[model samples]
Target: MGTQFWVKGTVLCKTGAQVVNATGPELDKFIGKISYGLFHGQRLKQCGLGGRPFRFSFFPSLMEVIPASLHISVIFFCSVLIVFSSVASAFFMYNAFGSPYETLHGPLGLYLWNFICCSCSCLVMILFASEVKFHRLSEKIANYNESTFVYKTYTERFDRSFWIILFTFLSHTLNILLIRLAGIQFPFQEAKEATVNTGASDLMY
Candidate 1:
């Protein structure tokens, strides 16, 4: 949240002068409406979860749903997808129970893999919706946009591997097969050249 210290500071100062030099002076006055904006702007402090300083992505206008100006279709689609994936993972994990313990080799490997993937995917979806920059409680209170704090908290992913490892985690499980239905492929084997007989290929072939 941010404070817009913009007030009509001009008419308070210039009375009739505004009538003659209305264009230039009026523009200056318009700029001065939020003179304190730059002031409060400097008071930025990084507070809460991630510790990275967050100012509002944009100065709040009269709109409350400014940041979420997402098309309902997009929101609805992603929301449904997230919910479906979450439930599917849960159902798969619950149905495909595995060994209670792990060894160097085992039959419950699928179960273990499913458990890992499900856990990681949930963590990632939570983090994907989170932000590293956090809102200071004071700032939120001042700007009246406390929800921004929650936004950052929800989408706080650290890096790509976090997601990759998450899917890789499930790749070992039945969810991997389901994800394959979605056309997602997880790398398992590394491609290698056929003992690239460099000398034989060039000289004999």
Candidate 2:
């Protein structure tokens, strides 16, 4: 055979892991600034998780999910309550001085307060509904889009009064429920019964 050279070699390789530590003031500062909120800086701390990586669950609890029909019925009931309360309050306030017998005496002040509250509640609800329905319509209008408008419009601003009215309505409704739950009859009911009895007695006489 002619001069031929063959080379065969075995190579051994070693793998090693490296550890890096991230501990510094900069990292700590970054973590401190990370937070979650409905609005900026209004951090919501719940369920032991509050940070940039917001942890959210669609159904956090079983009670949160309700049937659509039941939900609609509840909303309807609430609407009826708000409407009836508002109407009653307005009627009582309008006839505040006209009829003492029709309007409960001691609770006249209460009715006046209720009137003010319910009026405000209705106004707030109407304003909100209008905003939702008419805001887009207004936006499509040429006049409303002008940059030179002098005064600010109601649609442009969120009135804090809305929240006030909402809370008032909620509390008013709750009070009514509480009264019913306690089995306490309204003064108006007693007045009506008394009037009926008096009329019967007069007829008998």
Candidate 3:
């Protein structure tokens, strides 16, 4: 995730210094032009109105300047998300193709894995957002090792990658709901109902 800044000022004052206006290229200057991009794994590329576009990595180059602990935590949770997603997939296949056990290998297991992935997805978003917003990530990246004029954030926002993780979290949550809607009772609920039925049968006998 990253931010973009306008290369030039938008407003222009008339000779009387009262009327202000923007026209021509100035009106569309910021359109589809990214000042820079801080992507996941990919190079931090530069593109926009002026200067030659270039690329660089966040690791080793801007490592010290960025929040290492929070960044690493985000990465760690993302990895956990991936691993659990795969585990959930495997369990789904097992449930479909083979005779699975009741507790950990049945529908309950699918719910458990999906819930774990959802938690990991949430953690990834929180940690990354905290590292970005609270840590002033964009400004830090823009001003890293520069002796020139300080760079202020003209615009900042969470990019598509961040939104993708958010969608992943939602997908996991929906998967949980779908599992419940498929008529699979929660493990604890099934146990409690079975206990109640047994008690009622004993009373009748």
Candidate 4:
């Protein structure tokens, strides 16, 4: 979450034709590439004719410029993803190498944990994407603390880190299918079968 970014994009703005002091007419263009990740907030690389190319971090510096509530929500879901993924891993390890309970610590537990991790990963991607698109995140980050010029999103796309979470979701889904392939009945199916067997035995008695 902290290492890589979910979305990367560039913002551009064109300066006004005339200046107040007026050395000469000026129409300059500015462009900045911004990358937004979970923990590190956003990164900006300014490459424009108006100023020397530079780089900066947005969090704690321009933190107020972005939507705080939605950002926090993304972070929350990512944290949940990490926690539940770890729990699912531990359950897998125990189911393979250690003595497990018949129900909670068995196939049912594995399914439950994997499902949770999958759900959280999905939510992380959805919420982060929503924050970027609906909130106009790129434009906000580009225009932060800038009074002289306004910036517009020139290009935007999801980065590798975002797809990594998607792969994580797929992996959990695969694990669930593998559990079924191992000939273990789903919890509900197992319960229905047990109830039917019990009723048949009662009738025989």
Please tell me which predicted candidate would have the highest TM-score against the true structure. 4
Q: lDDT of each prediction vs. the true structure?
A: 0.32, 0.34, 0.57, 0.68
TM-score of each: 0.22, 0.29, 0.68, 0.77
| lDDT (10s digit) by residue, model 4, range 51-80 | 434444546765687778778887888888
User: What's the lDDT for candidate 1?
Assistant: 0.32
Total backbone clashes of candidate 1, pairs 3 or more residues apart or in separate chains: 10
RMSD, each candidate, Å? Answer: 18.0, 25.4, 9.1, 7.4
Sort by lDDT, top down from the best: 4, 3, 2, 1
What is the full ranking by TM-score, best candidate first?
Answer: 4, 3, 2, 1
lDDT of 3 at 50: 35
lDDT for position 197 in model 3:
34
Clashing pairs in 3: none
RMSD of 4: 7.4
Query: Residue-wise lDDT of candidate 2 within 26-135, one digit each (tens)?
Result: 22221211111111111111111223222322122211332323323433434554665665566545545666444433333433345445555565466444532454
| Cα lDDT tens digits for candidate 1, 124-165 | 344323311232222222234443322111111233433443
lDDT of 3 by residue, 1-205 (tens): 2332211112111211222233565433222212333332221222223332334456678789888878777778878898888777766775656643432324346677888999999998888778766887766665566563344444556556667788989998998887777667776667643543333322111
Candidate 2 minimal-lDDT segment of 10 residues: 1-10
